[model samples]
Target: MTAVTAPEPAEQAKEGEGSLRSSAMRGGIYLVVRQGLNVFLKLIGVMLITRVLGPTEYGAYVAAFNVYLYSTLIGQAGVGVYLLRHPGEVPDLAVRTCYALLALLGIGLMLGLEASRGLLTGWTGVPGYGPVMAVMALALPFKLITIPPTIALERALNYKRVATIEIGGDTAYYFVAVPLALTGTGAMSLAVSLVLRELLFFVLAHYYVGHGPRFGFDGRTAKSVIRYAGTFSFANWVWQARMLVNPLIVGPVAGQHAVGIVGMTVGILEMLSIIKTIAWRLSVSVLGRVQSDFEKIRRAVTEGMELQIIAVGSLLLGFAWFGGIAVPLVFGARWAPVMQLYPYVALAYLAIAAFNIHSAVMSVIDRNTDLGLCYVVHILLLGLGTWLGVRHFGMIGYGFGEMLALLAYGLVHWALARRIGSPDYRLAGLWFVAAALGLFWRQLGWWTIPLPFLALATPASVRRIRRILEQIRKPRRAEARA
Candidate 1:
């Protein structure tokens, strides 16, 4: 959908201020509620699986699944995301071909994983990861079930639909998987439960987005999505490499137990990320609608980034402060060790929040090649750091290396932003301070605390947040008689 150009800068500023704020606030709320549900489900799922199968088996399952997760991203399924930012001639047709290509790519990934099954297991020591990899191979094609549809919906600013699917799908995974683990099925049960969960979600996504993945491939549409997909392929490759860096290094060097610990911390780190992702998706879609209008895109990009840094940083700070004491109290004592590792990995989340502004800027400009280049630099630093870090050091080394890698990722954005002459210290500096403090001290939590100040700042930020809530709550007024 083409966004209507604002009549002038002042008028557009007023219009954008209200519109972007409303959209982000709405999207953030949907995600917050959905994340709350997902976190609940995750706790239940982890508790059941860990307690039932025990840590050793649970560790094996976590290790096996990450292998699949890493490889799938290696497919660089980022084109769909890029499409959301830089939409073109036809949305439906563009999305149609995107799905077709992914199906093909998914097939190739599955086969490649199968071909090296024996070697992969020997490397990971998860034993039977070969078959788990087989199930994971199914993720790409079946993924056609939801990803494209969700992207289209986000481009439409229909995040409520996304909220529904995530909450509902997560519930499905919990209800189904928790029961299976309870039944004494072991690690394989967790894998089967996950695959089944995706299949169920694929079916449900249809109800919200109309017909699901169609068998017929459209050549013209295929050609269209591929151009953007190629860009996505690069952006996603870097992103995936960053994600896989830990698992790749930790598994071989640290051992199965350490892999499990890292994985659990990753889950906790996601507590805040899940919401930011929804914000990122919304911003990409909204930004796409306004890119040609430089003024609008600029305002949208800046405000969106500021809002995200504030929100995400606050959440992370709060979690880092309390997680040390809270994790064991809530999830049981078995989780106590994980709490120690969390405060450090939180740096990655902070860096992501800080650099995310540049990521938004990059996607809007369609300069995805920069992403691939950045990943190359990041990977080299990460590998060297992780090698020595994991060898002579321990989880502390692994987490510290990750913190620096993420810090460097943000610094990359600062460099890019400076080149454009629109460098953002509110985003970069604020996140940097938060990460530094969170890693060393607890004072950063003040930024998110003070419910009264959020209450106060809402008024100056735009309309007060309470007033916005009132608009959402109040019934519509009836028209006066003509």
Candidate 2:
């Protein structure tokens, strides 16, 4: 479970040339497809739930689910990140030991959550949330059990298999939740589906991995994983804390109906975040494969960021232009409040995309402490901002508060990257331009039709895009040869 030092730069480049290209192309396609299917299934769930329950009820369910999400994060204890970041060959004992620890954490998390039932109910302003959270807590141990196999598959770049398992779990969510909702389970449908989803994933992952858990401990391996986990898990907790700003802070202050609006907006915003998620995952995988080769990490980080900027920017732009019209049409008039709040939510995604590569680079270089420190600051700033926003400005203020936090988050990375002399000014500049164009398109409406033509008209922009296309095509060519 310890890190292995990479070969020298020249040797790395020689070995990496074709490997990186194929990995990027094949892995990128499968991951994108995986995310695409995930989003589609998620939309189906959302559509069913929204149609079945009114916003207030849906918000109540979301609040309970949020508590479950937070619990899962604590239960996970960064085991997945720890496994993914391991530089050496992962031993079976290491995996088993991690599972043992995760299972214990899961049980502890469930108990802690159950004990806090009164606080959770008060925070979400829904007494039903207490029992709903209790139901959702049942899934944690199953979720924890799946992590070892899941991370093993991902680290080996078996994303297609991993994606299959994930999609299968999501498919189960729809099948289980929708029928229950029709039967008038109310918020219970969501909680039940959440547990079923994890159980399915656990069974599928172990089946594919051809392994079962072993109850053994390896002290050395435990120390190694725990050493990394300490920082990574704390950062994740802070992140979950940041996530709770809406449900924990804003929900009680603004009321359940307001929480419903915020929940739907955040959900839609997360769907849009798939693009950034894909980019971040692929970059980490790519960097992890090369280990410590700084130059290749730089190239991968740069090319990856540029491509993400274009794709994420364009997607956000489309959402900003079309969401106002589409939200009402798709989710029904009941969800109209999402449209007004979504544009700002989209900005947070944009800022995340802007600085995501910095995170990959940080991981590659072992700057996790720095990254953790940034997360700490982000939580403090965002927590205060969200409270003020919801208390005074209402639902839209939640988006504004997050937007402000993400801006600060991006700035921390920018300054860090600058100090390391790794900031990509040109790519970073494009993010702002893209954001402005998206905002303008939303503001000016149809008049921005010619904007795409004008932006891509630049020779440099066109060439960069062409290079990205070539990078995408290289893996297909490699596959054809095989």
Cα lDDT, model 2, residue 200: 93
Best by TM-score: 2
- Which runs of model 2 end up more than 4 angstroms from their true locations? 1-15, 418-420, 440-453
Model 1 residue 376 distance off true place after TM-score fit, in angstroms: 2.1
Clashing pairs in 2: none
Report the Cα lDDT for residue 332, model 2.
80
lDDT of 1 at 117: 73
**163-272: candidate 2 lDDT, tens digit per residue:** 89989999999988999988898888888998999999999888877767665688998887778777777766776675677678877788878777888887887787
The Cα error of candidate 2 at residue 467, in Å, is 1.2
Which stretches of candidate 1 lie above 4 Å from their native place?
1-24, 86-93, 217-220, 293-302, 426-431, 442-482
